[model samples]
Target chain A: MIEVLNPTAGPATGKIMMAERTGTLDGLRLGVIWNGRPYGDRVINSVIDLLRQKYSFESVTFRKKPFIGNVAPASIRDEIVESCDAVITGIGD
Target chain B: MVDRLTADRISVENLDAAMELYFERGWTDGLPVVPPTEMKVMEFLDYAGLEPGRPLGDVPERDRVITAEHLAINAVMAGCKKEYMPVLVASVEAICHPDFRFNHMATLGSAWPMLIVNGPMGRDLGFNSGMYLLSSAGNRPSSTVARAISLLFWNCTESRPDGIQRGQFGNPGRGHYCIAENEETSWDPLHVMLGFDREQSTVTAVSTYPGPYQVYCQRTANPELMLDSMADAISTYDFYRGTYILLVPPHFAELFIQRGWSKHDVRRYLMDNCKRSVADLKRRGLWGLHSSEYDGFAGVAQAVQPGDEDRYAYVFKPHEYDRIMFDDTTLLRRSDIYVVVGGGNAGPRLCFLAPYGVSTDPMTVAVHPV
Candidate 1:
């Protein structure tokens, strides 16, 4: 049998494993963060529209990242957290 | 001690049965394996002078600690002889090198590790260095050793064939991509120039994407002109945007030797002279600025401003062209330029510039005598 270790440890482990729960989509403000790839924005926009039609969600906020293959800056992540109940991020070419 | 079933010596037939069992269990890479019998495994452990449970290294991404016994088991499955353990150990060390960045590399959508063996071990293991050396010529220990190591990666790591190790277009090298330096044919041995003594056996593993693009310049006799051609070849759209190069075979070294040029001299020239202008890159449809979040022609903005000459100058500074073409020259320092003498003595020097996003350090395993 193979013994597996925790991939991240110490401070990194705590941050990585912390999960936020999401409730129903109805009337919830949704945010989409796009990583400048064309398909990413399109995918996020499609999801938003579909969610809106299905759940009659209140509103949507959109943020576009400047670079591909990189994570959004902490400020942007904070902005996303403050502005929307739930956020979806995407990356691609 | 008359014949109990357990007392029987595990013969070749029993080994074959075990191989079949491994296949039935789906533990192999769809290839037949030489069953690693307990005796064979023990032999390998003893040959490597390793304790059964000695830790090879921790595979971080998998979070699994690999012991010497684990590797020995896989080596047996890969049909590796007891003597090949040294090479396997070295390869493991190279992969686990902090600079090698194993976690990111394995998960990338690239092919399996491209094993490039260097030093005296190449010759000792009967690695082909002349005439279609990289291609399969059969029964070469170097080829099998590389194949075995790759197979070990698949079996041991979380990166399996269908799961995390997702390679879209895998090359044949994935099976066994290894060769040695034709040091006897070249002016200076590859490892010696790279700070290792000529007597020291070393292996340099370069993570590469696919087979190299050939840059042949048979007609040019002048070394300067030939080098310019080589620089131009390396400056192609794909290469210019990428990082790392693997200098292969006859042509490159032969030209230098014929003209009394050193590896350092050639490197300096390539760094100084090889470049593509921003205008050229733009003209070739290589450079473009697009919305990072969007795709297609609509998202693509002109990479360079039409009238911004200063920005253009900024992008194409001296020595910067080579950097742009292949990341930074810091990457192209003496350490990164892995030279191996191979292929026929004649023809253009075959240089393979590695594609972008591939790791530059190769995984090297030493070959021990069986």
Candidate 2:
């Protein structure tokens, strides 16, 4: 018989569970965090504008990460968390 | 002693079955890996004088805490010898550094780590710093050492294609990123230049694009003309431009040395001379919809040279592009470019590893041999 160990760091620990779904978008504050890629702002803002035609939002906040190659800074995160109720962030090209 | 291994061990009927199991589990890098058996993992830890559970560091962005046990298992699977444990451990620490930006590996840019090994340890381990150092010529120490790190990228950091590693077009550097700075040079070795003792071995991990684009400049001995050729290749319009690494061959180094040009002199020349004009700089290569307006040239990823009215290229200075009426855009500073002398004395060509645009500088860490 032969034995070998698992290669990965195994499952990640201290995983933050997915936040509860807001159930609905109407009357909720909308936050959009776009990676600073070209036209990303346009792609996101256009969608928010479309959504606004269907449902009323208390307010909408737009934030751009400092750079495309970094995580959002704490100040930006605080602004989003404090001013907005839900966020929409995009990934990959 | 370190924390006992907590990883579950699976019993298989034969080696082939174990390999099959590894493949099914998505543990291998599409190649045969030595089964990381219990004894081998413990031996690797002992060679590095590390406990199994000792946390090397955390790749916080990936939400992974790399431990000595994880390093050992991956190292053994990559077919590395026990003696290579220290180098692998050191490389992990360097890559985990915030400045190194371990989190940004998975992107359309497809940036991977290039390890520049220095000190006597490179020689002791028979790392090929000569011809084909970057090729798959089976230089055991360098290949296995780099492979071990790649395994870490796969297993611990989730660099698999199906996983978080989203490279638009990946290259072979993903498998093994050529390392081992040719210590046999007229100038101080890379480690010494990076402020380390001549005796202490170290590894510097830089987030680099995969291709080591070769710059052929053997016709003239003049340093200025050589920079004209090399600097043209270095100055590019790729995703963007930041720091660059130039592998200067011995013959190429001779041309500069004969002209009384030190490494710093070569860097300063590239910085001051290579600049692009303000008109050329107006085209937003990747920033806007004007990528097509790049001087009627298609895929001219190399940064646009100085346009008419201005006479400069790329060498990046922190000046406002619109305000500079007479100056061309600069790409990087003297300190941003790292020139290392390596490769066999025979080759007339040099290699350049370009950066992935705006990124934190590559970080170097000392290899603490046990």
Candidate 3:
């Protein structure tokens, strides 16, 4: 009779994967993407107002996404990448 | 001094040596454990009918991979019988499912998975489905199984006391949280009512962060009125809109049975009736609405759009009490309401709400007797 050997007794073989980040947020142009909802629009407006009052900005632009839980549209994404220093997206209810 | 084993066959004399090896390898839950002798480990591997090196699953976020051999080692340490290996394996599988989000669960500052057992295996494993079931009053298999799984998680995964698993106000359930769905007394078995085959045994592992909240109601006969009370309970400040509910005891079911009300009926009633006006939620200061950089206060002020008849709908509306009240219940079908019967017979009481910080739909794991 052929004896079946269990192979699972070996030492554990796996590693933890971590998320990656690009660069720091310094004087980059900030692009804000808002879901075309009342809450998102409102939050964007508040943020813009604060930036205007507090810091000097190189350039700032705004784009609106169609749905709350969805990614920004291609047009909006392109606009953000081209125009803004760093992108800020909001999922306001 | 430890006795030497012949042909990898460890004797009882090597027990202390094995425990010391485990301690050196950082494989313990603080509590002392019985050493996994080579013979005992072989027994567990045989019981699971698995190869000693079969990969259980990876703890993705932690970067550590788990295998059957690791689980068997932890099981022996947890004082589990070799016959319980199948249940342990199944629980590990359920937790590792992508939907279960095991990585998020380990780091999140809440108690680990609360194992809920259903089906015939629950009774066969000596789990408590009746009175004082949630408490540790009875010497049932529920406690032992729950403890065994928790130990496995701790040992295999990189979860240590103050390391990664940080539960601020840990619950007693942390010690071991395994309870059965009282199928005999219940009008519906938990798994069957949750869209599983009534005959087949299934384990669901839900990752809830805040633990469960209890909702008790008595003295209301009208189904609508009773559901309304449930709505109020679910709409509290702590209650989020999308969390699930676990119904306990037969009293709630008795009400539905008496009124010819299906789970769907209760869900619809709660959804339609449990809601307060969007204005009410804001007035009560329950909205944790955050303002963005662009909007400023002006944007936030504008976000409160005018509702019908010039009313403003709050950004965060109270969750449809109906959805939170019944799982498996669809908004349209009302009958999709998920109801599991358990606990001792008493007044109509239900436990609803999911863990805080994590997503709704906690993973539920059932430990079976092999």
Q: Chain A alone, TM-score for each of the models?
A: 0.72, 0.87, 0.62
Cα lDDT listed for each candidate: 0.58, 0.74, 0.56
iRMSD for every model: 11.5, 4.5, 11.1
Determine which window of 10 residues in candidate 2 chain B has minimal summed lDDT. B325-334
For each candidate, report its DockQ versus the true two-chain complex. Answer: 0.09, 0.52, 0.10
Candidate with maximal TM-score: 2
lDDT of 1 by residue, B293-312 (tens): 21233323445556533333
Worst 10 residues of 3 chain B by lDDT: B326-335
Best by lDDT: 2
Q: Give me the overall lDDT of model 3.
A: 0.56
TM-score of 3: 0.67
Candidate 2 CAPRI category: medium
- Each prediction's RMSD to truth: 7.6, 4.3, 8.5
Please provide, for model 2 over B137-217, each residue's C-alpha lDDT reduced to its tens digit, 9 standing for 90 to 100. 778778888888888878887887889888878857765674677766577777888899999999888778768888887
> Each candidate's TM vs. the true structure?
0.70, 0.88, 0.67
Interface RMSD of 2: 4.5
Superposed model 3: Cα runs more than 4 Å off: A1-93, B1-26, B106-111, B273-276, B283-285, B288-337, B356-370
